[model samples]
Target: MQRQHSFDQTELGTLYLVPTPIGNLQDMTFRAVDTLKKVDLIAAEDTRNTQKLLNHFEVETKQISFHEHNTAQRIPQLVEKLLNGDSIAQVSDAGMPSISDPGKELVAACIEHDIPVVPLPGANAGLTALIASGLEPQPFYFYGFLGRKPSFQKQELTALANHQETLIFYESPHRIAKTLVNMIEIFGPQREAVLARELTKKHEEFLRGTLVELQEWATVDNVRGEFVMMVAGNDVEEVDESLVDLSPIEEVVHLIEAGESTNNAIKRVAKRRQINRQDLYKEFHEI
Candidate 1:
């Protein structure tokens, strides 16, 4: 039942969820750097990694370790600091905090204890790659990462198989190839997809193709970079009860039973099933 007036001057301290650059240092926002300079303490996922960013920005603000391994032990200490009117800013190893990052739990804790949580938007890898992907940017589902285990990953992908919105995911260099293979199994070889990596930096690149093509590309000699994968929606039309029992060839036959020409029937069925009309025609006539 708590509402946050983030900018309001209050007795209790605020938790600032700060975002760091995904790759290029220039992408770092002015406000993000300013906030980092002013905050009482910075809770970083990796102090060593964050030191590079802090050093670049000349942000002298002291930092404490706050990452996945020690979150339970750190939250209480952080909460205490915040409760004592010490404004704290939390940052991930890269990109936005609390987004496939470590700040989510602390944000929840602050909310439960009535501490104000203020978020400052900055560089984000998922959206950065999404806009440039040449895919439908709106109606996007930001699924950060899938399960690590093969069985669990497959189960998760299966649940998302029928989703109509553009899908977004983050994967490590080590797992991208296997993940694409799994995607091919669930979403079919023809499904359109894009792979973006080394975002915002000099090595930034986007590999666009179908699931099968990307699967083959993933096995190339060099598969190394932070990856953001974008998958197209399930473009298939609703299965008509009459057409459900028919194969692609049979569906064309059923359509031909009507007054429509064979070519037109194949076109209609292909539109419904999201397959190539020419391919449908060839398969139908060959049978």
Candidate 2:
């Protein structure tokens, strides 16, 4: 086990994981701004976007591009600088550096090389939306983004169907309607959910209702802005043991009877049982 004492003085320069504003510029912490000004170099997800932020804060620190695409090429160079005692600060375009964003790879590299990595807490869209969601907050699971494809997305939802903790997900505007539809199918229509959008901005709004209602709103309303979707967990205490005895085909048939399409039902059953989806499809069709 390795322990990190962020403030301990060492020959290597510290790597600060600074969080920028999610939407409102006022959300920028004083420490984050100070770190950006003080660090020898700023590694940013997007230099152009970060330059605007730096200009806003009157910080003249030089920035180097450190995004998903350039991580492989930049980590070694950043690590080398850190070893030479040139302090570095990493920031994403908004929010925390590595939560469904770039910076995890560089952080891992720093840890492997025994570099001190300090984190400055600030705005996060998921936690910001969760407190006002009117759902259980303490025991929560943060699944940032679901798969985009229907088959893969439904399979993901199926795995999370039995979770007993609040579930948080990030979704873009274009796919929110489809995601809600899939949630309705797997988690059921009656499950409580909240959708928060344009968080911390002037046009921020929260829609709270059952999954069915959210699905309806998403379908008809002009769904714009990124979304933080918080879903109430499965509260059912009793398990249906009868399902265990059903054959693969029977399980698929059961899901189909419950409103899922045959292809989706087959996929879910195949995923849950750790069997090949194509083989299950073939066997079901043969019978």
Candidate 3:
């Protein structure tokens, strides 16, 4: 286990994760600004946008582009700098560095190289939405973004069906309707959920309702801005072999709905019914 004493003196340079404002510039913390000013270089997801922030704070730290498209190339170079005792700060366009943003790979590389990774607390869309969501905050799961593929998204929804804790997801405006439809299918239309849009901005808004309600609301207009979606968790009893009163398909569906993987659900149901796994799989999918 690696213990990090963030302020302790060390020869190696630190990888500071600085969180910029999600929308409101006032949300940017003083420590974040100080770190931005002090770091030897800033590894930004978008240099142009970060430059605007730096200008706003009167910070003159130089920045190099480090985003998804160029992470593989940039990580090695950044690691080398860290190894050379040159401190670096990593920031995304909004919120924390690695939450649906770049910097995760670089942090992993730093850990591998024994470089200290110090994160300063600041703005985050997920936690900002969570505290106001009226949902259980302690056990919520932060699912940054879902798979773009329909089938894969469905599988992911199936896997998350039975979570007893609250669930959070980040979604773009363009795909909210489609994702809500999938959630309705898997989690049922009545499950409680919230949609927080353009958080901390002048036009920030929150929509609270059931999944089906959200599905309808998403279609009301051209949905705009990034979204933070929080949904209530699975409300169901434990599923096991003793559910003898359930039909094969029903049992399998229950297990799948309760967050059990599709393959595991099929295997368990097949074993309980003393039937071939292949036949049960076929029946489950109507294949």
Best by lDDT: 2
Estimated TM-score for each candidate: 0.91, 0.83, 0.82
Q: List the residue pairs that clash in candidate 1.
A: none
Arranged by lDDT with the best first, the candidates are 2, 1, 3
Residue-wise lDDT of candidate 3 within 122-226, one digit each (tens)?
999999999998888879888889999989999998999888889999999999999999998888776789999989998999999878888998899779999
Q: Over the full model, what C-alpha lDDT does candidate 1 score relative to the true structure?
A: 0.90
In every candidate, how many clashes are there? 0, 0, 0
Pairs of colliding residues, candidate 3 = none
Rate residue 129 of model 2 by lDDT. Answer: 98
Residue pairs with clashing backbones, model 2: none
How big is the positional error of residue 113 in model 3, measured in Å on the Cα after superposition?
1.4
Question: Residue 195 lDDT in model 1?
Answer: 94
Ranked by lDDT, the better of candidates 1 and 3 is 1
Ranking by TM-score: 1, 2, 3
What residue runs in model 3 are displaced by over 4 Å at the alpha carbon? Answer: 237-287
lDDT of 2 by residue, 1-287 (tens): 99998898899999999999989999998999999999999999999999999999999999999999988999999999999999999999889989999999999999999999999999999999999999999799999999989999999999999999999999999999999999988987767899999999999999998888899999999889999999998874453587889998998999899899999988777656646678999999995
